[model samples]
Target: MSGLVLIEPTELYNILNQNTIYPCLSDTNFLLLLDARNKLEYDESHVITAKRARCDGEENFAIPYDAELECKTHVIIYDGNCRSLREKCRALQCANRMATDGSKNPVKILRGGYEDFSAMYPFLRTQKIIYLPQELDAISTYPCEILPSILYIGSKEQATSKAIHKDLKVQAHLNLTKSDDVFFDSAESEKYLQIAIDDDREADFGSHISKIINFIAKNREKLRTILVWSDQGISRSAAACIAYLMSYYKWPLKDAWRHVKSCKHTVRPNRGLVMQLSQYEESRLGSKVTNVDDPYY
Candidate 1:
């Protein structure tokens, strides 16, 4: 297997949430999360299921010999602030050495490390943890919320759930997938809009996005919450949210994407969709806008 030198925290989070059950690669055995911070830091706050390791002392960089490590398919090492040049180089060297030692397991360093991960998923932290309230549990069903208006990006299931709709008092629903799986009726208090689009590079979303933006803008004053959903709650819905932010708020594509991702860590628009958003930004700004690449993606 190929080794990955850097891994995104969102990717790691998804991997940990999978329900696969292989003999030698069960969920627990599938990953080895190593904390490259000091013992005190590890005790105070570390990634779930992560073991402490050192990268500063004489006997610092020894991989643990636990059974989980032996059977792990991937090894992820992370420090407190992985953005620093010194920490990045150290993590890279450790991952490279693991790869060179004839270990077929993919070894990776977490990008931006614990700092970024904690920012994205505050509930995972041991100290000053933010728990989701009962009312906001529906929002937690999806990866994250994209806006302060209780405007959320979620899966098709979440969009269709009547309980979630009632709990959040959702006023509007936008479905981006090409399916007739709508749950609410127009006669009801809620408004529903669906644009049948496939998640493909060639799928044109120009006019559809414009309509969706208009829909959101039109309902902005009257609605308390609007939910946008696709199949997996990752690609199409995220793209739509970004487009809405750019159109309604006059934000550049990069700034809008950053803001959305700050609220929803796993929102990754596909490359083609991102390119289209970049174009949309240029059109609105009347000039070419520089695309800021998401390093995590």
Candidate 2:
């Protein structure tokens, strides 16, 4: 699990906002905080102190939910309106489960969300901000200089074109006859890619997931905005399975979904499986869940 679940927003705000009174309880121990905002938003502002949950494609390995810690206190901060924060919080809940029993760690969110945190803690603005220019300079910014967008080719390819028809910064195209194998290879080699195969069924792809995670972990600084398009077509089974596993780590599913949706890729979730995932989150990590977003550990 990546985060915990809590109902009270005020309590969480107290724990994170007023660090002077609450104080970071850990002594000679490290605190791991996750900011589940996109790179652009994170650059503008964030609070997680030790390490932010970076793009899985950019990160080489899953930052163990509970590894090498003298303390269990971990915080997850997310943007309120953004569903990614909630999704990420859910992941933290899963990670906490894989940790030791009788753990006293706390998982919290900020009150009033990202904007409120920025008011109390002003330093988050410079971390990784992205600014859009009013006009594009051909000499300064060329078509190929920025990240290449994901191109989708499926039965409903035309639908995807309409999703991003007006957005020129990212390109989305369709090719109906393309094969999954070919698409996977091309995306891996050409564009930033993160493949999430169900460990339960597609164990064969475990090595593949590991290899990619390792690559991202080692080269996190160079990668940005991963392209997620599964070869599992027309079957929500694969998408749901992948989303479930990806959600296990509290990844920003919205980013992933938005990326796919822009290409008109579909997501079909299993009712039973999705329910099971939610149940697992609530039962396992409910202890540490808080509604506050603590930017720095």
Candidate 3:
């Protein structure tokens, strides 16, 4: 694995997003996404700009000898599992050959392959459920588990769905929406709290932060899971989660945000919320904390 580079789904997503804003960037530093899955699976659903490359049998996979592809600054390939050393070797050999032929394109494999990538972005799957919410439809397209069984961040629909609650066995919920839709029932083992707040930059979550953090602390010993959600699961709820992490774990704003985004890549807290969280951090630490300016992609 000396020359092999592994790219995470979040990194790939960032690259694609950056390319969209700067079209010329792609022309100069192109990324060629190769799907190493069989033709059938590739045809059904693949990454947005992925092209199929056969990795087994008669014609082993090879990078196309095209000026555009050869000139790409980075190339990424993903199989169903990407666990085969032999396949990796073959792919690397092809890349070496291309380099020898003066292409010099660096080749890498997607970490965890297509499965992990699709898990991170379920909407990319051709046969995936589209969880649409009333507000923030664009942002609420996908819900993600941010902390395995312990915590989840998702859309309002996911928060309100009884089936989803049962499936995930979420024993507790912290709702950040103004709606009265109840998803969790009161049980000895379960708890629910809803903070009626709008998703505005100036929305004040000052009063609710301590309560939410206390709820999580109380449930920690019982092994109860909590789901935090807002209209789109992007801004208000995400900000709350960041604040909880900072308070409970003594984490700085940027570190807590990075931890959350590692699991829920789409979590984006608004600037006002970021300011509030930074203030919370400063108050907690009795010192000024660095503010994070960029939103999570």
| Global lDDT scores for all candidate models | 0.67, 0.35, 0.65
Best by lDDT: 1
Q: TM-score per candidate, in order?
A: 0.52, 0.28, 0.61
lDDT per residue (tens digit) for residues 1-297 in model 3 = 124566676656544433111222234346666676777787878776566675547545564545365566667667775644345443444444444544455567676778887886654555321222322123212245555457777778778777666656778888888776575543433477778888877788876789888877777668887888898777888887888888878988888888777655567787777777878888889875665655442
Off by over 4 Å in 2: 1-3, 7-13, 16-30, 48-50, 57-61, 64-70, 79-106, 109-112, 119-297
How many pairs of residues collide in each model?
A: 0, 31, 0
- Where is model 1 more than 4 Å wrong at Cα? 1-143, 185-190, 292-297
Across 1-297, the per-residue lDDT of candidate 1 in tens digits comes to: 346566666665544433211111134456666777777787888765566765556534765654344466777777776754345455565565555554567777888888888776555455322323332222234334566445777777677777667655677878888766556554543367787788888778766778888777766767658888888777889889989998888988877887777665567777777778777888999875654465543
Cα-lDDT of candidate 2: 0.35
Candidate 3 stretches greater than 4 Å from native: 1-4, 7-52, 55-60, 63-76, 80-108, 112-140, 161-171, 185-189, 217-225, 261-266, 292-297
What does the lDDT read for residue 182 in candidate 2?
29
Weakest 10 consecutive residues, lDDT, candidate 1?
Answer: 17-26
